[model samples]
Target: MTRSSHSLRTRDLGYAQRVCVAKAGKLMMQTGQLTPRARVGLAVSGGVDSLAMLAVMAIRRRIVPFPVELLLLHLNPGFDPHNHRPLVELCAGLGIPAHIETTDFGPRAFSEENKKNSACFYCAWLRRKRLFDLCATYGLTHLAFGHNADDLAATFMLNLFQNGRVDGLSSRESFFSGRLTVIRPLLLIDKPTIVRAAKAWELPVFSNPCPMAGKSMRHEAETWVRSICAGDKHRNVSLQHALGRWQLDRDALPD
Candidate 1:
């Protein structure tokens, strides 16, 4: 569709309450994440962040100039048996195709046999591998994740404090020799904003059933970031600015 046609259609959708969707669309265009006629696979975990991502992408697909196809991929780690149903129904309401997979990654990750690895680590690894497999099987060019700005900040602190690295999550990353690109369009938005967006969009948010939900290193980092940004009104902005500067310097360095 032409730009004018796309604008008209977006106006017709009457999505004024979906400011997050517009912001996500703009971010995708700014970062060159979504190409024309791209098949995008969204990893929806039924959580607020992922559900918000799905809602925004669904709106974007309606009015984007390119012929974009969105497919939902929900991985059920058997943490909760009924968790996948809401995700499936949400996709159906949006008229998008969804693929749901069930695995024992949850139980096995926490089992004694895998005591060497953290449950979070094992579950994340398995889910990512499964996502890549799905991408290859379904011919998807790009995979979209719901890593927001808070996630980015927390990860940066986590690496700095725990791993002796200043690295954080990138908005876009490539894997398998650039065969599949992973994009995080929500990298520019914060968690509170995403929560508000989820509410405004009426996303079906599901609670994570992981026993280690609020006790990981990431959680500690999140608490630290929040406390640092608590009293100072501009602390969050300063951190974001610092991250941007660091990214520029990092990009300019040798590979």
Candidate 2:
């Protein structure tokens, strides 16, 4: 039985539909990512990637496998809480509940770190901790981040050169401390997919400068990736494909 997006409530989708919230709902099912009844706690930073993923997941709720009930969790580590309003509006328009919270990750902590290295490493580490804590508080089992394939590839290369690791971000990981599972549904998608989808769907962009945007190494990497993509078109897509194929050929490469 086929169902349109109009027929879905917050609880109709099954497990298979939860992780592959943006792609064909059956992808995860066919791959056995989840059973028939999984719930996902999505993290939305009010960015194009996160917003795009949110909209896609909303549409996916009317799908099969598992109904993904999105609980928008926003953590203001150093970014403005007001900067997240667009996400609130987007959720409201989508008729989903969005929650906001602020953590006192003092500005000093970020400023001090920004001097030696990009602010992202420290800030992101903290935000992730906050996000995980929120998931535990809400009793949400699976937590999703909006990291697309582009991010994975860039980070992988960056880590290879800088961190001496062959890993970037894992598709599915269990938080070492909390053992909470984290996933990336959009890991196969890229910035173009996100940008086009956000514009096409009119996803609200939260106007906030992540305190370490231009100064962060990941942001720098993103800029570099975009610059190269602008000059040579295939760099972006090729990297994305490489990531997927690499994972397929060797799901667990010895690190």
Candidate 3:
């Protein structure tokens, strides 16, 4: 890429980032969960999704007409001990406080003791438990995740096929009798949009260190869901609406 071309690409990416942030912020405001003065714990996993979520939330905090404090939280999962510095630095650059917890959740999940459940299941359960504990520890009013619309659809299919139910991921779920709310601001944003925005913003997205990174049930479900959507943005959004998880306006995209 030539210097001018590279600069143009960067500018386009910056515009993509702005659009993503605007859509995310709009969805968050629609949910009415991210209130003023809310202390939110953002779960950053070093993946493009979570990293992009961090950037979107950080930017939204600044431009939105509210005073919300964001804290970046990462659980190392014992797979890589030295991979958290980039996330910490990113949080620093965004002027958000970060808390990194180094745990052996990954290894333990694959241990023999965890025989019944899949490693992904065990690892995710433990990670969520720790995140919830951190939220309580920090007295955070909300915990934000990077799960997007595609995740919601795949999860719905996963549950329907595996458990035989209509249960799907909720955009806003309350926990601890409403003391701490779990919010998915990207719930209405599709995965491709997130990928594009992440690329434009040049987030420090690292490869998944989990041994079963692309070999899990969830991965299979995601692949199947992608094929079902077949790169159609409208199909992706319609699937999310059909799952009854989101009530977005017809003009979902920001002008």
Candidate 4:
């Protein structure tokens, strides 16, 4: 099927397919996105980030020499059915099979007693556990998450504020639960970049009305980062470069 052109150029990279993927593919090839005969499971929330990720990966698949099998996984952790329908339609449009795992952790779990806190930690932990279990059942070797540079930035500040140290998502991570490896291809792309790419491609999006949406202080951190980086413009690029160059002393800070 021929693809339409316009703002969606980012999603439909036909014009720049060869050049962009070649560039992105080289980085991916070095990072195991080019693993030979690997079955990869992407934890897709059907948001713009993951959708753009799938779009780019689809382009890379056509040119990357390595054989990669891709699958999409979505967890329905008690969100409105109406709110999640678009994601289902999206995977269908992309022609990728999506796995939906329903996990409504009983009522009182995040109830009146826990009103003080949103209980997002409990909810996310539950989701990850289910994702891991699904990976084991399906024999998936690698997992892809939609975490981007902005998320890493937000997390670094949050960690330092909460724990008095700097730490955040790495390009690669290992899940000890089942020896499964996880990769964040978007780690190099900032949220603004992703937004630009998504808009450039005219990709349709879904909303996340989760109970934990705006309450977190992370919003404040993101705003602060936006303000600080607004002037330098290269602020984010510099941050990624610095983090990329980091070598762990392990004992660099107090234990």
Leading candidate by lDDT: 3
Please, what are the lDDT tens digits per residue for candidate 3 over residues 139-200? 99999999887787888789889889766666677899999998888877777888988886
lDDT, residue 170, model 3: 68
Clashes counted in candidate 4 amount to 4
| lDDT tens per residue, model 4, 32-148 | 444677777888776888767766665555556777777888776666555556656556665667787655742323767555544776666667788888888888888888776
Error in Å for residue 20 of model 1: 1.7
Q: lDDT by residue for model 2 over 8-79, one digit each (tens)? A: 334543433333354524334333333344556779877778876666667765555555566788776654
Assess candidate 3 and give its TM-score to the true structure.
0.87
Looking at candidate 1, what is the lDDT of residue 255? 43
lDDT of 1 at 25: 75
| TM-score, one value per model | 0.88, 0.78, 0.87, 0.80
**Over all chains combined, what TM-score does candidate 2 have?**
0.78
44 in model 1: Cα distance from truth in Å?
0.6
Each prediction's total of clashing residue pairs, residues at least 3 apart in sequence or on different chains, is: 0, 8, 0, 4
Order of models, best TM-score first: 1, 3, 4, 2
Once model 2 is optimally superposed onto the true structure by TM-score, how far is the C-alpha of residue 59 displaced, in angstroms? 1.8
Clashes of 2: 8
Q: RMSD, each candidate, Å?
A: 4.7, 5.7, 5.1, 5.0
